[model samples]
Target: KREGDKWILNGQKKWIGNATFADILIIWARNEADNEVKGFIVKKDNPGFAVEKMKDKMALRIVQNGIITLTNCEVEEADRLQNANSFKDTAKVLQMTRAGVAWQAVGCARGAYENALDYTRTRKQFGKPIASFQLIQNHLVEMLSNLTAMQTLCFRLSQLQDQGLLKDEHASLAKVFCSLRTRDVVSKAREVMGGNGILLEYNVARFVADAEAIYSYEGTKEINTLIVGRAITGFSAFV
Candidate 1:
């Protein structure tokens, strides 16, 4: 039921980052009249609003993700976003978030590559630094190549977005490619560290685990691939 100019919200949202600490929440609900999704800005400490912190994440433990529940949560009509009318409008928000995730993948990969390279330089084996060895050098070169390529791809992706020429497929392609490459770069980083790689204090292990999460978020590799596939083939392969 509506009260004056306010509407009621009742539902749950999962895997929301910072939900446990955010002062304001953007709640998406379907309008009963037209069945279109609408966005609402609900303030913290509102009646009937509750949030539970998500726990035991193997990766990205630093991020405070949570599950939010709203029970007859009151939100002013003025709090509703004026432009978001449906899920299609929601897509605009997701598109930007997806691009950010892609760039994050690049950053993660670059960090792993740099750390591993530095460790190999100082880490000695057989009385000499491992970075001097051919095998070790090869791994470093390959890691740099993939990291550089991902950086360039994300740079172009951002440029396209700035130019207003970016499309869903374009962002999807970068997300898919960069995320997969990040996984590879992290793996190489871990491999170069040998047994020390698995140790959390070494940092490579954290990157490895975090890369797994990055690989799956924004959109999984398979999902993003299909998005690009559908665009290129002119056929909707998504079932």
Candidate 2:
């Protein structure tokens, strides 16, 4: 039931990207009337809404993330999303975003690989370019191997999406696999950079930390693994 023709929203959302500048935010909240999850298009200038920019981010400095709070925020019934009746609808949104995150992992690894390769070519050690070192070449090869595998896997993943054959388990499998391998590639890229690896100016450090966030967000490794496990075993392991 609408309270005097205005719906009141009260909740907190963390790590909301572009919340400060977004003109319309698709907010997912629990409906007070039916206890089901609902979606709302809340404008940035809504009176009862407040946003705080999240600070102290070591990675993904380019992404504008915020902490949003809704306190009796009023919205018209017409603004509510009609299709979102439960968490299943929310899962639909996350499934799409999770696939995008997998692609992002690929791009991020590619960027780090390119940067580290350039650095190794230019940075000299022991009267020779660091790229000529056998250990450095080995690291580069390993990174390339992981990157190539992740790329091929995500390519098939998108093909599945285009064919409408993607399932939760498929997305979870891709997310888990790509995120895990991206972490490995970024780590190796950093390792090959010597002391400059951790510096943000070197750029690999950002990928390294951002990979951690990508790994955990949307779904953690444990959660994604369980989703795939449940699909294969036909038993829900998530308690």
* TM-scores, one per candidate: 0.94, 0.94
Any residue pairs clashing in model 2, and if so which? none
**Which of the numbered candidates is closest to the native, going by highest lDDT?**
1
Model 2 residue 60 lDDT? 75
lDDT of each: 0.90, 0.89
Candidate 2 residue-wise lDDT, 1-239, digit = tens: 35876778988999999887888999999877888898888998887899999998877778889999998888888888989889899888888888888898999899889999999999998898999999999999999999999999899989999999888888888899989999999999999998899998998998999988888888898988998999999999888
TM-score of 2: 0.94
lDDT at 74 for candidate 1? 91
- Per residue, candidate 1 scores C-alpha lDDT tens digits across 61-178 of 9999999999999988899899999988987887888899999999899889989999999999999999999998999999999999998999999999999998888888998999
Where model 2 places Cα greater than 4 Å from the true spot, the runs are none
